[model samples]
Structure formats: C-alpha cells, structure tokens
Target: MKPAVGAIRRASIYAVVSYGGLVLINNSGLQLPSMWIAYLPMFIGVYVFTQWVDRKF
Candidate 1:
C-alpha cells in the first residue's frame, strides 16, 4: 500500500477506536458535549503527523 493510504487507514482505525471509547465513557457519566469538535483537529493533526512521519521515516 502507498504510504499515504496506509497512514490514513491507521489514522481512521485510531479515530474509530478512540471515538467509540470516548462515547462509551460519556455514556457511563462523563458527559462532554459536542466531542466531535474536539476530535476534528485531532484527526487532522494525526493525519498530518503521520504523513510527516511516513515521509521522514
């Protein structure tokens, strides 16, 4: 697989797992409103960093 594609796939897996865990935690009592907003930058940031890493390493 291309480096970019691999990076994206791994990032996606991470996003899904993290989001699910957060939602589960929220449901259990840590109500954080509009968590998607928090995740937006993180998602982009992770992608950016992963791309940089993929290129650098």
Candidate 2:
C-alpha cells in the first residue's frame, strides 16, 4: 500500500512535467507532432527512470 501510494505521487509529478514540457515546446514554435515525438517522450522516460531509481535506492 505504501509503495502504491508513492507510485501514484510520482506518476502525478510525471504528468505535470510532461504536460509542462509539451506546452513549452509548442510555445517555442515546434509542431504538435514533433513536440509529442520528441520532448514529451523524453520527459516521460526520465520520470519513469527516476521512479525506478527511487524504488531501487
């Protein structure tokens, strides 16, 4: 239950960062497709990686 709760929290943070990254990229003149293809995945991947690291440590 505790690990589940922590996962939910980390996922929420990832959502925020992913959305924020998309917004920033779009505003910076990147096309929607490109933004999703590039920046969004990186942000999500990093977030997941960090969560894995957290659990490991």
Candidate 3:
C-alpha cells in the first residue's frame, strides 16, 4: 500500500511539473505542433528529481 501511494504521489508530481513546462513553452511563443516533444525535458527532469528524492527521503 505504501509503495502504491508513493507511486501515485510521484506520478502526480510529474504531471504537475510537466504541465508547468508545457505552459512555459507555450507562453514563450514556441508553439510545437507535437506538444509531446516538449515533454521530453519534463520527463527527464521528473526522473532526475524523483531519483534524488528517493535517495534523500
């Protein structure tokens, strides 16, 4: 149960952070036809952040 909850929490964090990235990109006047491309950075960012958090917490 704890592991499931932790996974959910991590996924939620990634979703929020990725959305923020998408908004930032759009606001910056760089409109991507395939917005999924923009998610690359967010995915990497979230992966690194989660890894660090897991190690530290």
Misplaced by over 4 Å in model 1 are 30-57
In candidate 2, position 11 carries an lDDT of: 74
What is the clash count for each candidate, in the order shown? 0, 0, 0
* TM-score against native, each model: 0.48, 0.58, 0.65
Stretches of model 2 off by over 4 angstroms after superposition: 31-37, 44-57
Tens-place lDDT per residue, model 2, 1-57, is 988978887777667766776677667875554445777577867687667756764
* lDDT of candidate 2 at residue 14, scale 0 to 100: 66
**TM-score, cand. 1 vs. native:** 0.48
Model 3 clashes, total count = 0
User: Superposing all C-alpha atoms, what RMSD in Å does each candidate have to the true structure?
Assistant: 4.7, 3.3, 2.4
Worst 10 residues of 3 by lDDT: 48-57
Candidate 3 per-residue C-alpha lDDT over 1-57 given as tens digits, one digit per residue, 9 for 90 to 100: 999988887777767776777688778776778766776777788778776675565
lDDT of each: 0.64, 0.70, 0.75
Clashing pairs in 1: none
